[model samples]
Target: MEQYKRKIALTNARFYAYHGYYHEEQMLGNEFFLDIICFVSNPTLNTDDNLVKTINYEELYRIAKEEMAQPKKLLETVVDNILNSIKVNFHEVNEIEVSLRKSNPPFGGDAATAEVSLYWQSGT
Candidate 1:
């Protein structure tokens, strides 16, 4: 079997929104970083052409931005939305992994950041 992999890593994808359980946190939105990895089946390798045969990363970025803009109580929910959005929008993508990180959370702690990642593949 032939496999074509194309990875689009967007680091430090900053999104400011209220997404915490605490009252103060929910009222005051914070910045979050999102990293997305999309494993797609490249058609250009077989056809030797770049005519709508590959995934449109620009569109993916738009989708991610839209999803990230929405405020959610849990990072898990946001990650899930990102993965599901990609899966539905891009059919060529066989698998996707989304990592959402909240940098310098309101909760004062030793940890620098808090993150949640979700992996979703085709079928079950």
Candidate 2:
């Protein structure tokens, strides 16, 4: 039998946070959006409809929320922290992808948002 990977995702999680390089950006705060995807092995194992057999999305949300609550200077740091936290908490996860977006970034242009996407695989 061929083995396949399963993915669980949380999309468009919105938060207001104080995360940026500039002091004003921190004090004033901005809207941040997160989309997280987690990959696991043997998705069919959860066919029994047991929560324990699958990744709990609420748990992921809680972890992201907790991590986002603390301010950080760069989105890269925030992404790293989230990825590390998820990996530590869920050993079954094989890979994780995160997309973080900040609205109205300080650059002097009509940019709607600034975004970062990061991918992490276990044992790499």
| TM-score per candidate, chains pooled | 0.83, 0.93
How many residue pairs clash per model?
A: 0, 0
lDDT of 1: 0.78
Give the alpha carbon lDDT tens digit for every residue of 63-85 in model 2: 99998999999998888888889
Mind giving the per-residue lDDT tens digits that candidate 1 earns over 2-81?
76676655566778878776788778877788888887655456366664766666777788888877777888888899
Candidate 1 segments exceeding 4 Å error: 46-51
The best candidate in terms of lDDT = 2
Index of the highest-TM-score prediction: 2
